[model samples]
Target chain A: MKTVSPFLELESGPRVKVILDDVALSLPQGANLAAALLAAGVPVFRDTPISGAPRGPFCMMGACFDCLIEIEGTTRQACMIEVTDGLEITRIHHDEALA
Target chain B: MTRSDLAIIGAGPAGMAAAAQAAELGLCVTVLDEQPRAGGQIYRDVDRVAPLRGDILGAEYTYGATLTASLKHSAITHLAGAIVWAIEDQFRISYTRDGRGAQLDADHVLLATGALERPMPLPGWTLPGVMTAGAGQILLKQSGVLARDAVLVGSGPLLYLIAAQMVRAGTPPKAMIETQTRSDFISAAQHMGGALRGWRYLAKGLKMLASITRAGVPRYTSATDIAVQGTDKAEAVSFISNGHTQRITCDTVFLHHGVVPNVQAARSLGIAHTWDAAQQCFVPKRDEWGQSDKEGVFIAGDSAGIGGAKAAEYAGTLAALQIAFAAERLTREDRDRCAAKLRAKLAHEQAARPFLDAAYPPYAQALLPDDSTVICRCEEITAGDIRGYAKLGCIGPNQTKAFGRAGMGPCQGRYCGLSVTALLADARGQTPDETGYYRIRPPLKPVTLSELAGMEVTTPDAVH
Candidate 1:
């Protein structure tokens, strides 16, 4: 585990390449997308629409919408999505200026 | 649309048990679940994660596999990864799966949608690194991930369980800030008789606490005025303990007080709900058999109320037995005989709740945080906003929609509904029942218009 990362992965697996905000990442394939992102040091899932405040998963059970992120083309809860090869993920925000 | 004699939404202990029991009684059952597998939040990803981390997660989690295994019957069809959005009339359930929408009709509908952690709203809860202990547990279960140097906050057995689980994972929490005070324990002592009858739950909690103690995680009880300290993301937690303010620096803050019944679908279906004073949330009204006031609808599991897993399983089977008898597949006597043990077991499982509820009431500050604390994350609405709306003559959560758009965000107030109700109730000098919750409607979860457009078009729903 890296000293810089706030989270530590308990298991090791073959990494699959994916891109977040145009940055290439070798995330563990089939792992929870939210956990993988947090472990990889991407804390901000999406900025709020009104205040542009940073947010991440809270409930992680699909109840809280704080973890919403754009996967492929649609905005979905990162906690509910699985990391896969070639998955293009980015911040999901209604505020265009923040984007 | 697929048709079945019974349709169960959620594949947790309740849904799976209900499906198995009803199917065994010659009823065709279909169980729809959001996860790719059966285990609900309590034992999420059981089959996949249990084999690897069963000891860390503890035995109670792995036990869910027994319920999951029962779904292998041919009479029971399990639809995994299905997000149920609408529960229409006549038991027509609409859901989205893999970006596609589908509908199913059933003779009876059992909603085991389950419970969600009652939001612990504080100054910096919306920050990136702040999450619920349940969320942390989910990462541990689903992906074997653990937060480094995290501080656990709030009250209840769940906090202790997660702390111990983290300890077992070889990364104990830096500290635990407890909200339950000495008076809370004194009040909880009144329920000792029931607590005694439910000794196993008490034993489990003690065992978890023992593990945390063994790991030397500093635990502070009676913490108050708790707040996360950070600007952009969570950096630490600040709280008052024993008349002194203390701050613990940590990247992650896991906050939890207790869980409340996930009542979105139940309320959307227009099931009658009463404000549960002890649990401090609105719960759907149901009979002993889990039959709701609505015809042909049954609410079970934590979705009905926060009864935990074992109670939910028993409740589910009881509901299924009642449904079987109503369907005329089983005689009334037969149904009663089958449900006799289940009802007893359900009551037994619920025996310790009174003590737990009194001991770990929702954090007072979190229930109504300071003026600047954000209560509604979706809208960035603060507690002061709701209190302001009340001053402007807003008496209910529904009025907040027009007064300030407090709960009109994407989540439709799931996280902030209870807090809004409490704020309004406190402002208006009324009880929570008088200050009713938001009137929920269908398309419960956020669903894209395209998903609805592509849904099965036959037999259009009459616009309400």
Candidate 2:
């Protein structure tokens, strides 16, 4: 599946390489990290502990916790965090890390 | 510890307006927000994103640029990337910024935290690709990225606005499955005169609809029994339209059903709230000047109710003017004169809300997901689980929380508060209000113990 929509690439900005789950991808600096990851075709930010059902960013605002991911050893809302060069992001599988 | 005459909770239109007006009136103002930038969700990243993306965000968004510029130029201290965890008695605020805990005392506090999209829980809504329409717009606004192979579900002006934005970006949704029934239009017709009084809003909606229509995006109206079907991720969306089952293949499914005021902060402060049946949500009770039942506290903007950005600004200005008068910075006549124009503008801005609210009433049935559907995403609680608790004599959301940890998640009842209330109400055969909402507690947002321990404390008399 093509993750990055072609429309967004129409105008380029400063690019920064961030490692997501050890896979490095170049995204526009200061762009929302969750959006950058989603555009990069990396879905399923976390899995439900009970059902292990995949979940990703829902409401990009802080209202919904669906976008929670592990960044810098702390789980944070990916949609709320801005992308920076060399930032390491890891997918969280359970809610325990968030607690 | 920091002290200011005025402390504003958000940096949206309301917060910015209050800060600007208060600062201009010679009050020491401090504004704290969770976002990295001052612009709240409505104008999220307006300073940086608007300049880069140009008019792709539409005209309403451009207005935010002026507000943000003013905020930047104001003497008020603005703290971005700060999460206010608690607002205690004596006008004390506890917040964490840059991994450090801090406390502040203010003579007056303004909550302009704003609104959240109404939770539209449906079958398969928990699927990975399904997200709120507002989220998709945020992606565009913050990063200039549009979801590919998307299908929009539910109904509201926001749904149309987002779809139109996508169309303008040359990445229109594959289809729009609107759940608005014929009755909504009938109810909306009754308020047409009031809506006409605010012709600009009606015109904007009409233009957005026309643009979406012109884009030739396939639209399915009166869509019912909508389901986002998927295994590992969203593969297709199925809905009944015109009494016929229709399915569309899409990776992204954006759902919207209007918005509700985010009353958590006010509720935590124990402010009075009244259920506005028109908007079908709990709104913090406030006076004309945005003063809540709690003295020295004000609820402005969508956090008070869903009056949009313009109304928020007017209300913020009114609140600041009132505060200024209270501080003896302005005489009675001066305060009244300043507020008079704002009051009129606010009335004009809110004139169309009733029509919009009636037209886009959250399809209540859709809100009550089937037994198998997940209601609380955090604890993985299903609708059936909540109903089971209700059957076991859970009378309200508070009791239901004890039976099952529904709202006790990282999001703190934000995702599931409404659903739990509605489900309990249905089970008890009572209105949602009778079932009651969860009692919000402080440490509103999660805070680490280390951060809390690091907080500076001062005696009450020291600040004075």
Candidate 3:
């Protein structure tokens, strides 16, 4: 569902690498979530419903319970979640059975 | 910056009475109120449309003018429509008026911001056709507009008073639903003995009941489960009474479950408060003089607690006397005598409170409506979202933040705090209050970034 909410827009930044829930990801400069995860330098995807499973961004504007991950020891709504360089995101609940 | 010996923050009965008494004792007083008109909500002028000729507008005309004129005669100043947004220990106040922010200083301050009707979320409560009984009165009294037909729901002295006002104004309501059961009336009666000190008050309450009876407004006592039904507006309401579902089709529903203190100022000041289960709202703790634990800060009237106009008047006098006595303006004996009179008034008000509470307990069932019910009207968050968070091991508001964005809305949990507590209790098989709602932290209202830009930031040297 396309939804409208408030967000601080940014422009013109260098690509930074950050990890969300230990997920290694490369993001554009000024891309908040991408920058934070690459800075954390972990390659984890998402979080779990129960055992802190791996989850990634779903509804970013604070709607839809999808893109929730622990960043800097605080669980934040991913869409509304801002990103910075060298940030660490942790996974809680719904652990992935690594293949 | 303007300064005064005492700054009163409302022009209601308590504020007016306090200012008058303090001024009479040779204290310089200034009354700052947010209304263009002197009288606050309770004694709002009804003279906008009709002439001040009848007994109906008698209280407003008498008290309002007398208070305004008294302040004029004595060493008291009146600043109307001044919204005092912040207060500190040194008696500095920040207020906004005419789109400008200003600060005033005082030696002593009395806060009498008064009360607001408890917001109950029935279906379509946010619709245009629904309003608080108090709001309805304001529209009729201030704006001279009346709903073609209104259904007054909830019970208490105010309920009957408003109903009588509506009926007398030729805008008779279709029904008056009393949520208090007859059985509960017994408890309410126990407090009647205290109120029996005044024959006139008893007579007035009886007269109101008589008026309501004469209006032939259907009284649905022992009513439960009130539901307002409408898509874009409140078209009607349904309630189950005596094991039967009855519906009242009306254009407007005026609801007044009870009153809650306007705690924005109190919370911002960090004054300690205790839950007043009787009124189902938090009341600031105060001494006999209405002085809070926060030094140099005093509370008065319903803001200290929910007392009627009469009780509030006495409380104002008591608070003023205490301040005066402390300043050595009055002997200890005079303060004690004043305190004795205040004690009597407080006792009478307390005695009547049980009857009022029993007559209208906070409609607990109203908090937990159907799952599809919208808990946060501003955010459109339904009861289902709350439940979904709980199912995902979300223990409380803090933990629930991870699972679902419940309470992460513009209101900052004011509208949903009580309901969220109730929902958490039901999920955990605990009491609602035990679940514990969110703490009210300051900057109560949301302020724009630009507004914050002009604010004075505190430095380490400014701490003292």
Candidate 4:
């Protein structure tokens, strides 16, 4: 698959395939999850539970919760998480579902 | 429970310096951080990234490798990838690591959590294509990613540094939309004497500007009324510069003004804070030793205030010296002697701050955005909502939680606390100090219930 990322990588290494929101993306291992997704061209991380507005990585650091995603039934900051192979990631939706 | 002489939270410049210093002073120190590696945002992934992109990031960033190297000591334990959630009573630190919760009991606690980019809450700022320049830098550092045709927005020394870095990376931004004007320079001119004393910083800024100029990127200075123009994502940046309205087409918009201390963890401990008028943010109150108003708790580095990375290391060492004296590892004379030169160096590093703060003051409108702009990204609370809350007798940020869940979202007001205070203060005719910040609630950074419940409560003290 061709990379649709608007982001360019200075270096690329081993590829690891992960499923994000039911779509498979071959991302670079050892990359921060948020950056890896952007490098893979995965659109928005999750829609705002309040207004259903699209939000992605804003602060990249842990301070902002803009890039919230779910992996293995646990919701976490995509910026904080690492890129690992065979991971199943889902977009977090609904205020009550935030974990 | 893990017991240590001092539990330092964060592995950034301050935390690394403190841990190394305290360890050399014979204190058992354990440092924790959310990242899997040492070096906070300023130097994230220095061990890996520096070896590759050191020239692009510049020596200032790769210098973090020295701090990381100093942490190699037997007396210091680094708990990497630990997301600290709370600082409980009696210096008990609660955190999660690898899907499990844990606690650390320490004789003293040092917070060096560092700063967050002040949110520029304009319309369409929350769009996917809009991110802080800090975040963009993080992508470059951690993943070697660069955005295509990004427009750099706002003012600060950091904007120049990143623009230079991007130029070196072969992806110079479309244009620079800076807010600092002639009047800003005129206001900052009063501190020229002090700024001259901080010549190194000025020299570095000039070098970055030279690099950007060499790259031939268009610059729109004295820009005002800037907004991210897009229906769903940032397609362009529209602003007024030099008395003319203009728009620059771009795929990404990087926003920044300045950074304020990330004070949620420190504030949660009931640490007394004071408003810094020049910086326009509330910072934890601490003495020369970096000890907060609360007993046995110290806030070093940007967590205390926005001292640069070098100053942060000195501040951390000073805090460690104080802790060593308190721990009976160092005599009063020894502590003072060790900290004397450090305090002077820290002051020298910080001498540029007054001029920089005056030169790039936070945008007035963004602080208390006009009615329609969203102030709290977590709750989608508009600026008008906060104004309405003040009219309805909402005196402080805490009231917003009840009025509209402004600070009750998952982020716990890390991004919106200052804006809420500013808006309420504007509407009620009160100072930011009088308006007051939110009462921070813990689990500071979202801990899973299972992790908390599954945490092992070992014997009170398990000294390794």
TM-score (all chains, Cα) for each model: 0.97, 0.96, 0.73, 0.97
lDDT of 4 by residue, B1-464 (tens): 77899999989999999999999999999999999999999989999889898988888889899999999999999999999988987788989998899988999999999999987898779888899999989989888999978999989998998899999999999899998888999999999888999999999889899989999999998887888887656788898999999988887889999999999888899998889998889999999999998999999999898988999999999999999999999999999888989989988998889999999888766887889999899999999999988888887889889999997888889889899988888888888888889987688987788998989877565686
Q: Which stretches of candidate 3 lie over 4 Å from their true place?
A: A1-99, B46-54, B57-64, B198-200, B387-417, B421-437, B446-464
lDDT agreement of model 1 with the native: 0.89
Candidates, ranked, lDDT: 1, 4, 2, 3
Question: What tens digits encode model 1's per-residue C-alpha lDDT throughout A1-99?
Answer: 123679989889899998888888889989988889889988888888889888887878888888898876778898888888999987765585255
| True-vs-predicted CA distance for residue B104, candidate 3, Å | 1.7
lDDT of 4 by residue, A20-58 (tens): 767888888878999988877765788787887888899
True contacts kept of each: 0.91, 0.65, 0.00, 0.85
Q: Residues B345-408, candidate 2: write the lDDT tens digits.
A: 9889988988988887786656788898888888888899999998888888988778988999
Q: What is the C-alpha lDDT of each candidate?
A: 0.89, 0.86, 0.64, 0.89
Docking class of 2: medium
Model 3 native-contact share: 0.00
- Residue clash pairs of candidate 2: none
Candidate 3, B1-464: lDDT as tens digits: 67788888888878878888888877888888876556677765422323432344335334555555555645888887565767775777776554355667888888887776665766656554566777666544443345556798876777887787777766678898778787777776776665565555567778888988897878888888888887544668899888889998976678877777766577677777776677777788788789988876678888787877777778888888877776678899988987897888677666655556665676655557667776654455667777777787767755554455555654456556666766776787766445555655544433334444555544323656
**C-alpha lDDT of candidate 4 relative to the true structure:** 0.89
